[model samples]
Target chain A: MTSILSGLESVKQALASQQFALSITQRNVANASNESYTREDAVFADVTASGGAAVSIQAYRDRFLDFSIGQEMQSLGKQQAQSSALSQIDSIFNENSGQGLQEAFSGFFNSFSSLSATPEDLTLRQQVLSKATALTSELHRLCAGMQRVQYSVNSSVPSTVDEINSITSKIAALNKQIPGETGSGNEFALRDERQKLLENLSSLIDTSYYETESGSITVTTGQGGLLVAGKDSYSLESSPLSGSGFQGVQLGGADITSTLRSGKLSGLIGARDQITGYLTSLDDLAATIAARVNQQHAAGSDLDGISGTDLFSYTTVSTGSNSGAARSISIAISDPRKVAAAGPSGGPGNNENANLLFAVKDEKLFTTSTETASQFYAHLIYRVGSDEQSAAEEITTQKSILAQLKNQRDGVSGVDMNEEAVNLIKYQKAYQAGARFATVLDTLSSDILNLIGA
Target chain B: MRVAQSETYRSFLGNLETLNERMNKLNSQVSSGKKLAQLKDSPASSAQLIGMRDQAAEIDQYQTNIDSGSYFLGMADSIFNEVNNLVTSIYAKGSQSASESVTADDRATIGTEIRSLRDQILALANSQVLGRYIFAGSRTSSAPFIVSGDTVSYQGDETANKISVDRGLEVQEGVPGSAAFNSIFSAVDSLLSNVSSNNMDGIQTALGQFASALSGLGIARGEIGANLGLLNNAKTNLGSQETSLKAQQSQVEDANMAEAVTGLSQVQTALQTAMTAGGSILQQRNLFDILG
Candidate 1:
């Protein structure tokens, strides 16, 4: 009952449909390696209940999967950021190679030991001075390194905020384009593009997307800031107080502290604060060591027959919530020779010089505590060592926790090369079969056309 | 549970693929022996480890301090013993000069010998241990005693030289020139004057002063000996304390290698089984063929 001419038209339509399917398969093969690319499938429908068919492409992406991945990524991102900051601090305080404050402390102690043996030896006196100098230098270096790490964190926070704003603007723009382009039900390309945007946005900041009936996506920050609502885009801007160092971010003059918790901005902010706290502790250690050592050294008698002059000079800077307070330390030898030669009498008969030496040696001149200089120094070394050891141990524990979290996150969203290879082979075979079916349809149409001519 | 041929099934497969990739990464992490494989893994822990490592490095310094203290103490003891011998020599010279058979010239010679002995005492008092005047106490920059015209005086204070042997215990190891040698010099000065004048009455008085000087030296020697004993005791206690602290610290912080290794092996086995089982299930279902 059907005309041969109509059969040819059906066959031509079938060929066109098969070509579209082939193109879609090729697109999948190309994007199998792309992290953001969702594999697309052909949507086929029988043509008006006749023996013909038409095909449309459908992207095989789950909205729920994307949403869940984004949430997990956000958590992983924050952990990574915090971990980075802590590791940097660790490198700054590298203690294993004997290149830290501990070594300097040991050197100082050794100098005192040598002095005890040849107390009147000029060479030993010089060694003590040298060792003292080295110890103070080590303290200064450590304090400076900690401060530098804090400064780096402070500077990085604002830059990350700027990146978040740029990503938000991009998402809002995509939100506008997707709804208009997909209105006629040909939204495969638009959806693909939007998915790519979401993936990109996730890396810069934690994001979630909402799909409306019109196929438009509404994007929001992990912290719940409206990134894209219909056709409009909301931007985030940070107004950091000078010297407060990028403490918080603002979106449209409203504070969004909770919203920024899982993004790169949050990570940077946390890192800055944590590093600053660590630097403060290091400064405290340096100040305490310098002050205590100088106090003991100053109280004790020196070879030059003078007392009270400091042995080490430490740089003073105001710290804590109380504002400006002057603190300084100086540890310097008052005299570098024998007390007898240092005095006017210039011999061992000088009782005044002898008395000074006796007082220091006996620790009777120490007005503060009954403890001697050597005892105090020993305690200081032990205290500092213990503090550093405890911190390192804590760091190790935190690292294990971080590792577990990362593994959990990776379990949900990592790419597998073997899976991609299998997908490529499968899609390739399907494309070939679709192409052969189109050829057979063409041959049938040709036979029908010849019959019509006869 | 049916073979997933629909787009939803394909999407699920994609998720499973991603999950497999993550598992591989986790496997590598486990094998690497470090929980934090990168700087970003755990920053706080890394920083803390650095601090602890620095502390471990400093333990050697405390040991060095103990060794140095021991060396100083040894030198101080030797100098004190020599001063004791010098005191004996001066007493012998004074006694010989006090004999009735001795002439003025002989007395003069004895006086010269006494002055020489005084110089020797000064040398001992001004003895430098390491680079410091051991007798000068904390005033290590100069000699504690100065001698001029046969009169020896202490340049340093009467305070004995003390070093910290342990917590709350400081041991004075060096006798000050003012306390030990200066008084002896004064006693010898009086004895020399009596010998030169041939005054038997003065000689008798000077002999009493010399004996008193010897007694003072004996007391100083006794105090130093006592302090040496205290130092030895403190050193022993510190050694034990350090050993106990090290054990406690290890318990608190160090990983138990045997336990860790066992745990690691268990996790590895579990991971391997999961991978093999998951692989077999996927293959038996032939999900890829069904989807194609």
Candidate 2:
């Protein structure tokens, strides 16, 4: 009777184990579409002394794939950010539309050529003033547009830091909970959630991380700024720079803006600097143009026979710095008669000075007198285009690499509906067999009872 | 390797996304007729396009200069011819008056004609075009020739107002009033006195002076003619240069419609095939469906 009861107990245990296996299959099927979910299996084992089955949950994942994907995500994030910023800048320098600084510049110079044709024509003098004003306005527009791009890019840094801090804090919480949930059936869920957070954090900032034996992760910035350690996470801060008022990143009160070499944050920083450099070049161009035109204009005489005054006026940021030259450039003289279209032997018809002013168009005025103003501006546009192109190309390459890695990872841990369906049937059949065995055991026990009836 | 359900879906979506991107690019190209919509599409080509545009603009300016230069020279050339004709008429009258058979009354009648011719020459010298004296050199706002007593004095300076007609080339727009009319005015003044006083030797000397003055006017007119020729040549050269630059610019920026349309259709067909394949694959029965 003890042996029959023991056989019944073993069958009951077998039924429970098979049901648990079916439940695991059900869980896999339910989460088949969840991108963050890892497939789980009920690993069955027999109880050595008790002669019954025991089960444990096993989650499928490749640690190496996770690490590789995280690294690739950082690159993808950086390229995407830079590409977006550069394309915005590319639109501002849209010379292809024929309504750019190039047109203004050529128009301004060509007006002088026209004035040289008929210096006595008051109408042509007015045309020169109008064209000069237009050129100055164009410079102002371009400079302002570039500054707006920089401001917008800089403004996003704080929100990005907030997002990174949020992710790190959640990861820290997961780190604390993962150890307690280890070896339990719920641990796999915590691990998968933690991995998703880590990937999210890595795309915002460049980070290196490793999982410890205790199932917790320690994350640090690429330049050794501690972000997450066990159950504690350090937060990043954004603050304005001293002179420029641009935002800079900080880690624990230390400026770490330069240390961030890759990721979205680093990409924004690089693009900001690139735009600032371009602004400086534009300022230099503007200042050089103003100075050269003013010099030539001063050497000539106007319609009233007075010596020429400055044709253009601009305010410099400081001594020897043309920081705001482009933004501040404006025509100094409003009177059309002030346009010096005459030589030192001044008359209403002398056009030697006007000819000289027109010659400025083809002069090598920038880049150590190697390129004309137009050429210099064209080069600036080319630089922006090339930068945007490279970033776009890098994004494509990085996306393919990430896709390949993700595919390999999905092969390792992603759910297979067919496999889950088959497991469902197999476990159901085993449970049915276990139930039938229990029925047979019951019949035997009853027969034994009848044989011993009084 | 085991293909997960999500993996097949992901790859199919990725392929569809790629095809859609190609289709979008081809559509933009076909619609805009410009292969380079943005500078980022091709930086080198964009830079070259800008350069070509600059060259084209420069050529346009040079052509305008040529036109303006031609007008100034053409006006001056015709005026010089008229002045030469007047001077020749006076010289013919002076030669006839210098002969011994001429009576005082005849000399006096010839004097009136010569004075009228001189007055006509003075009007021609002060000829204004568009409210500016054409012969005033750099002082074009006022008449360059001023009548003083019996002779005309040149008020205009010796500056030859030059306009740029080509790259590194300048052509004088007008000669100074002094160079064009000073000698002719002086010779005409002496011939008028000689005819009114009936002095044959003085009339003969004034006729010799008139011939030399006519030659001087001829030289000035010749300079203006040469300038017009230069401007015409520049205009022809610049026109052809502008055409070639525009052609190159078109090559750099304009899209090939045939290629773009062909690519658009090919991408459309590929996209249709991919969508159909994905649809069919997604609809295929799995193990769960078979069990149901």
Task: Return the TM-score for candidate 2, rounded to 2 decimals.
Answer: 0.98
Cα lDDT tens digits for candidate 2, B126-209 = 988877888888888888888876689888777777887677988788678788689999999898877887878888888888
DockQ for model 1 equals: 0.12
lDDT digits (tens) for residues A1-454 of candidate 2 = 3488888888878888998888889888888888888889899897333565488899998989998889988988888888888888888877777788888888999899999989979999999999999999999888988889988999989989999999999999999999999777689999999999988887889999999899899999999889999999999999998877889999999999988888899988888988998899899989999999999999999998899999999999897999899999999999999999998857888999999999998899888889998889889888888999999999989888888888888898899888888898999999999899899999998999999993
**With candidate 2 superimposed using the best TM-score fit, by how many Å does residue A313's alpha carbon deviate from the native?**
0.5
The candidate that wins on TM-score is 2
What does candidate 1's lDDT look like per residue over B1-292, in tens digits? 2122222223445445545645554554456434443323343444344434333433443344446555656666677688778778878888888788988888898888878877887787788764557676545466767766656666666544444444345556555656667678888878877877888778878878877787777777677677667767776776777676666545444445565566656666665666676567545543334554
Residue pairs with backbone atoms closer than 3 Å in model 2 (clashes):
none
TM-score of 1: 0.67
User: Lowest summed-lDDT stretch of 10 residues in model 1 chain B?
Assistant: B1-10
lDDT of each: 0.57, 0.88
Top model number, lDDT? 2
Could you give the interface RMSD of candidate 1 in angstroms? 10.4
Lowest lDDT sum, 10 consecutive residues, model 1 chain A, at A321-330
Candidate 2 residue B65 Cα shift, in angstroms, is 0.8
Q: DockQ of candidates 1 onward, in order? A: 0.12, 0.74
